[model samples]
Target: MASPITPSTGLGSGLAIGDIVTALVNSDKLAKQTQITTQTKLVTTKLSGIGTLKSALSAFQTLIKPPVGTTSKLQFAGYSATSSDTTKLTVTSDNTAVPGTYSVKINNIATSSSVGTAAFSGGSTSAIPSGALTISQNGNSKSYTIPTGATLASVVKQINADTSTTNISANIITDDKGSRLVLGSTITGAGSEITTTSDITGFTIGKTDKLDATSATSAGYIGSVPASASVTINGLAVTSTSNTLAKTLGGVSLTLLPGSDNSTTTVTVATNTDGLKSSLQSFIDSYNAVVGAVSTVTKATVSDTADATTGSTVTPAALTGDSMPRSILSAIRNELVSTGAGGDLSVLSQLGITTGQSDGKLTLDSTKFQAAMDKGLAGNVQQLFSGTGDGSNGLLARMNAAITPYTQTGGIFDTRTTSLNKQQSDLQDQQAALDLRVTTLTATLTAKYNAMDLIVGQLKASATSITSFFDSLNASKS
Candidate 1:
């Protein structure tokens, strides 16, 4: 028998060999438990990395190989501003925006002018008979009574009605502190000029000449410009009554609005080939960014190469640095540089863009590239990145179509994230069970040790009792 060690210090000699062995075994188990916890975290991170990579790859595939399989198309149109008359509006069919023959209609016309009037004297002078005077025009009538001493202002009031009347409207025009009686025809157009047909008894035109009709009229005109502006559309100079011109050419109609100068307007038409080539270049740029991100996480890393003797694949973690990212980028760069079936340069090199080997970055010779573009080397750059469908095939349209599925109630990303949450919840359940096991094991182990300690104490008392009894018997014999 050995003395057991005190629980606090493990220093007594009453300990069993099994107990020491259990303590050493528990220490090794704890080390393994720590490794398991670290590995669990690594697994979770790898899951997230995989999800992001899938998304990036999906985006890259969609860009590189477009589903529409056709390039984009674009046409131009303009508006006419030759008519000063703002109300001369135009309408079209469909968009009626086509360049065929379209017409405009005029609405709401007007004009203005001034006229002369007579004055009266009081007390029945030679100029007038005094008392009251009547004024009439075009079947309308009004009366004014001349007082014994009527002032110029009083005579003026009779001629200028404060408000509306049947034949014509009358008012006083004032400036600074001075006032002049004015008359205007309520109707529109040049025919609406005001004139006094009848005179009052005491009033006359007088030696003081009447005011000019033009002086009272407004300056601007209401109808469309009498003349039209000349606009040359695709070499066809068109004379339009109004400023707006809608015309069609090559199955597409471009509305030609006379430019602001209203002089010679020049419009340049882009051919279909030019439009398609421009569209293709845009696709290449977008695809490269996404591929680069995915490659960063999927490549081999430094930690993976460590502990190779352990026989495990030692995938310490997925590649996370610049080297792998650039490698993946280079793969995509190689694809773009590969030659197409036709054209002066089969690949992007023909377009004056050369890829660098170290990092897959591109260098553009702008002057040379522009020269190729000018010569139509890109072969309808506009068509490559977009489809010619009416309102259905631009880059935005294609991206929207692809992303629509992910937004649906049961979409892929939604399902995947939900699955991850369920897995994490299950792991939490396992952790709880493990915690209960640990608690129960600690309690049972402590209870067993306490019982063993009590038994050892009992044995020690028994040994002492026996020794004392034997010594007493020997003393008696002596």
Candidate 2:
């Protein structure tokens, strides 16, 4: 902070005036500068610590409360469906599926109906007479105007464009004889069939016609009849328009695969023990992660021996004395240890989750969890974790409620961080004010020192003149 105009050394007084001014300015601002620095460091460190804690809490919240359009992890903890022969069929079940075994026999998988026109001699470039062509399927009919000079490929494109309305698609298949226009329905059922009729010449459209061009009595078109999936579950016959039968069983969906015709398989719905255990373990791990985060932020380290050079042996974390972490842990612990009102598994301990004594983390007893599942307590466990659709009953719900005040917007952590940020901003202002004061003090001290140096120089000049006068008088007397 040395000013360019300030003299490095006084010309008359022979003293370092610039150094003296700078020293005085530094001394005046030292205490306030140190205070601001300390405060700014504290606020920054605390903000970082709070951010870490908030991240941990948010991760835990995401695990408990998933986003919309997603199935909850707890739903998969109850029942699972397995097929004896997956090649023939596969099955999936929800929580509402009953635990039972069923014998399923597949008569045939459903197939869509397809009809092909007789081969034309002009291949894919075959021309057709301009007329209105109507295609009907499942009682839905769509008409297309076949313009003049329309080739087989062009007509196929027009027909396919209206497939959404007709539930039918058209394609051109070329063979050695020529190209044929094939139309197929997008649906599969007993009454779903593709029937094409047009006033165009040489376009014979019928259900029983053959697609071959070499036959003496070749019909204008050939078609394959649509069929539905036929299956028997536990000796009861069931029919579905598609291969996937969802409503056949309550909460159970059966999918028929290829080679399933005349095949039989068994499906067993049972408790998903491994899945439930893994989910519980995940919950335990997430809870422990929060505990670990809190510990990291609040832990204190004390040296075994205090050395004179080191000043102090005790070091505290940013949040060592903060009450927020303690309060958060207390809230979570209260919910974990509380008992539900009405459920077979009222507490988490019943599901093999217990809190640790030394470190407030959760531990899972795998043996006990497996035993609980083996005893058919999966439903009770699910209810315990998820509650009965109420906001306050379930473990997850209660835990969410407990932490909401701290994790929500304008919550405890946010408030603390905002306050700390404001403190940081205030510290910056204080530092700026201190710097300005120092600058002003330096200027004042420099001007006063320069004036004093000038006066001293004048006094020395006067003394030298007086001595010269005395010396001249003494010379005259000699």
Candidate 3:
């Protein structure tokens, strides 16, 4: 009729049942947990390595083949323009400019046409009779309606509101006498002049006259006619509607300064070897950066002492022995050494870019590069690098093509990353399942041990009761 005694510490059974159950559960889960942890770490490290490699490749690609609306540092042909007298005229040249010397004589700079209204006695607030005002410029005319009780300032604002259509703008110029309404044309050419006709009373407009005796106190046009830039290049006369003579010479832009009139200057265009050399050096550096990344990820280190836990003497990188990085490196190296269809300077070695024998990095031979430039092979070098605008011929183009597969969307790197992510997820699931199994096992073992302890306690209790009864009976018999 006695109840069984069950204690977690197992006092009745003389054993630590709780500790035994814990030890058994741990023993069952340790191996599986260890495996899962190791695999997850490896997957995470590999993914990080892949990301680093991809980033390096993308940077290199941007330098060589930049995105749309961006220009690559590598120019097909570079040129510099020098002016004999910068004060007289300044010149700039682009890749399209031909290397040559030109004798430029600037006659006059272009001037904009301007006209002003007679001084108003009422200043900016002077009222004018409401009427229609028409402004004409470059054969285009636009009419503006002057509102009732319009002031000079208000009329100027109204005129300016239609500036885009009329090619004219109005402003209020105030001198010691009074305020005057000034109108100027946005364009400057022989026939592009601002002319206005208005029926508003007290509105008298005339061209500005710089030569008039009282012109200093009156508002008028500065010159008699709209002027254009007059210049002669190499004994040929050239007229431009703007001071900036962009179409006067191929690849050359000349700006006629104020003091440049009646003065002659020489513009010299030459090859820009310095710019080309700098770009070439940048290409070498970027290429080497990619190579360095690959080397780092694929390196294996032999330690002097073995790791205490793993007990391994050789430590390999996450991507060590991985064929992806090695294959990428090999593909790019092939492009660097391969011959191109470009003439004369078809190979990188011709431009002093050579691969290192031991480290696989590019080295620029300054002496060889200068010699090639001195030999007048700069154009050929450019051709080798930039090609003829076609996408298939140059070294940069070929290198871009070679690495596109690995760096593009859903490419090799992406595929590898996806696989690694799935592997990580699967490992996590395995860990979860193992943890669940261990939990279940622990509960089952604990229940069984508790049941056994209860049985032992009951047996001991009955034995003690029987022994006590026997001792009592023996005493009675004695």
lDDT, each prediction: 0.45, 0.82, 0.82
Cα lDDT of model 1 by residue, 1-478, tens digit? 8555545532233555356555744664575556546655655765576466556645555554445865322221121122223233322222112233322222212333443333222311213224654444333446667565554455555556533654455444443323334455443333333333223332322222344334322211212212343445445545543343444333323233322333322232333333333433444455545555555565544454446545555354344542533444545554454332323444556556666576454556667667766675543232322334452343334444454444345765466557656766666676676667666666677566657667767877788899999999999999
Q: Can you give the lDDT of residue 345 in candidate 1?
A: 40
User: Which ranges in model 3 have alpha carbons more than 4 Å from their true place?
Assistant: 1-8, 11-14, 76-78, 83-91, 94-227, 232-236, 242-244, 255-266, 389-391, 454-478
Candidate 1's C-alpha runs over 4 A off are 1-39, 54-285, 302-305, 308-368, 377-379, 390-416, 469-478
The list of candidate 2 runs beyond 4 A from truth reads 1-8, 71-76, 84-88, 98-103, 110-226, 249-251, 257-266, 305-314, 389-392, 454-478
Q: TM-scores, in order shown? A: 0.44, 0.73, 0.74
lDDT of 2: 0.82
Instruction: Encode model 3's per-residue lDDT on 61-157: one tens digit a residue.
Output: 9999999999877665667788999998998776677789999988887777887766666888987678988777777778888889988989889
Cα distance off (Å), candidate 1, residue 94: 19
Q: What is the lDDT for 252 in model 2?
A: 84
Inter-residue clash pairs, candidate 2: none
Query: Which candidate, 1 or 2, would have the higher lDDT against the true structure?
Result: 2
Candidate 1 TM-score over all chains jointly? 0.44
